[model samples]
Target: MKLTNINKTFGNKKVLKNINLDFPTGKTTVLVGPSGSGKSTLLRTLNLLVTPECGQYEFEKQKLDFAKKISNKEKIFLRQKTGMVFQDYNLFPTKTVLGNIIEGPTQVLKEDKTHAITTAQQLLQKVGLADYATAYPHELSGGQAQRVAIARALAMKPKYILLDEPTSALDPELELSVLKVLLQLAREKQSMAIVTHNMVFAKKIADKIIFVENGEILYDGSPTEFFDPNNPNQRIRNFISSMTLEDL
Candidate 1:
């Protein structure tokens, strides 16, 4: 995705100002920033989830003109191409694990139930949740629920997965489990954008690191450069200090 001259604001406050970024295909690009720094906002802009007040979203070489009126059908098509995973696992309480996983494809994609169920089973196995397919969300741990969310997103066969603080709610051990799965997915799938505070995970998994602060792109480089000592960005330094403390 190529974002050109992106600008977003909420009332008088500008969140993303003249932001330009290029997200490589089949690569894990992690957006790292402090809270309320617009990392989530920029990620959401990829699928037009939070439509930029002004910008050109060049997705798959097709530019989505933000100024023009977009039809509902076009929005839905964009949604199909992108899958999102939030910090909180948004599973349906009424649906079993398997039921939650198969819901999207069967309902939105209009896929056959048998095929959806079969695919869901494979995804559940992939996420190491095959045994809990019949369990409710209340019965699963935070890590398990998050993995189920990942499986549900995978069921859509989305080209890119946008993750928002994927393990913020989990315990250390559970967070490790989820991070390991995410690293594996990054290595194997290579088409995801993760917004996270996990500096270690970002260093290990991201093909590119986008560091933002004060609602702007402070640094856009490799994880090596992100961790470089000579870098003069004080905000980056401060953020890394906080991340190190948290990781400990």
Candidate 2:
């Protein structure tokens, strides 16, 4: 997927500014920056959850002009191709884990009920939640809920998986559980673009990193260069320092 000259505004504030980016297939692209830097908004744009006022988005050989109004059908089609996992697991309160996982496939995709159930079960096993199939959202721990959220995203068989601060709410122990699942996905070369503050995990998993601040991309390069302690970019160095202090 690719975005060229993208722009978005909310009220008097412009959250995204002429953003140009590319997410290569079968690679992990990590979006990292301080809070309110538009990382999450950019991730949302990948799935068209947050539309830009102007830009061109190309995904799966289909190009969309954001300057024009995007139809509901187009939005649904794009969303189905790009699965999204939020900071908070947005599971249905009344639905079971299995139910949440199968909803998109069975309803949106019109996939067979039995086939969807089988796929959900396999995804549950992959995310280490095989035994929680019958459990509701409120019954699971934060980590478990997040895993369920990941499973739900995978069930759609999307071309790309976009995540926004996926482990922000978890403690170190719980965070590791979720990170392990992500790491496994990275190893499999799943196409993903993630907004995260976890620098360590970003360095470990990212094939490319983009640093955004003040609604602009200040850096876009390999993880090695971006994370290098001796790098000359002052802003990036300072941001990393602050994030380290926050971790302490």
Candidate 3:
């Protein structure tokens, strides 16, 4: 995915300014930045959840012009290529875990219920939540809820999954379990863009790391280059200093 001259402003506050970057396909890329750095805004723009004021986005060779209105049909097609997970597990209050997993496909895409159920079961097992299919989100812990969220995203079989501080809401132990599931997905060549504070997880699974500050990209390079002591970006340096090893 490539973004060019992307800009977004909320009222008078600018969140993204002239942002230009490319996200490689089939690679795990992490976007790391402090609060209010616009990482989440940038990710949301990619998924078309937040419309940019001005910019062009290129996904798999298709150009998305934010200046123009997109048809619902076009939005649906783009959504098929992308899935999003949030820090807050946004499961439906009335849906069981299994229902949450299958709802999107069965409703949005009009996929067969039997096929959706089969895929949902496999994804639940993948996320280590096979037995929680009948359980409600309220009955699960934060970590388990996030795992179910991941499962729900996977049930769409998207080409790229966008994760926004996925494990930030969980405890350390729960975070590790979810991270393991993510790493396993990466090993299986699932492409994803993760916005995270966990620097260590980025180092371990990310093929590339993009550092952002003040609505602009500070650095975009390999994980090794990002950690290199001689890197010139002050934002990168400050971020490293603020992070503890445990945050990884």
Highest lDDT among the candidates is held by which one?
A: 2
Q: In what order do the candidates fall by TM-score, top score first?
A: 2, 3, 1
Clashing pairs in model 3, backbone N/Cα/C closer than 3 A: 200-248
In angstroms, the error of model 2 at 157 is: 0.3
Q: Which regions of candidate 2 fall more than 4 Å away from where they truly are?
A: 246-248
- lDDT tens digits by residue: candidate 3, 30-51: 9998899999999998889999
Regions of candidate 1 where Cα sits further than 4 Å from its true position: 246-248
Candidates in order have lDDT scores of 0.89, 0.94, 0.90
lDDT of 2 by residue, 46-99 (tens): 888899999999988689999998989888888998999998999999999999
- TM-score of candidate 1 versus the correct structure, residues matched by position: 0.95
After superposition, candidate 3 runs with Cα above 4 Å error:
245-248
TM-score of each: 0.95, 0.97, 0.95
Query: How well does model 2 score by local distance difference test?
Result: 0.94
> Which wins on TM-score, candidate 2 or candidate 3?
2
**Tens digit of per-residue lDDT, candidate 1, span 1-248:** 78998899989889998899998888999999988999999998887789887778877746677777767877887789889999999999999999999999999999999999999999888888889989999999999999999999999999899898999999999999889888888879659999998888888999999988768898998888888766687678778888898435
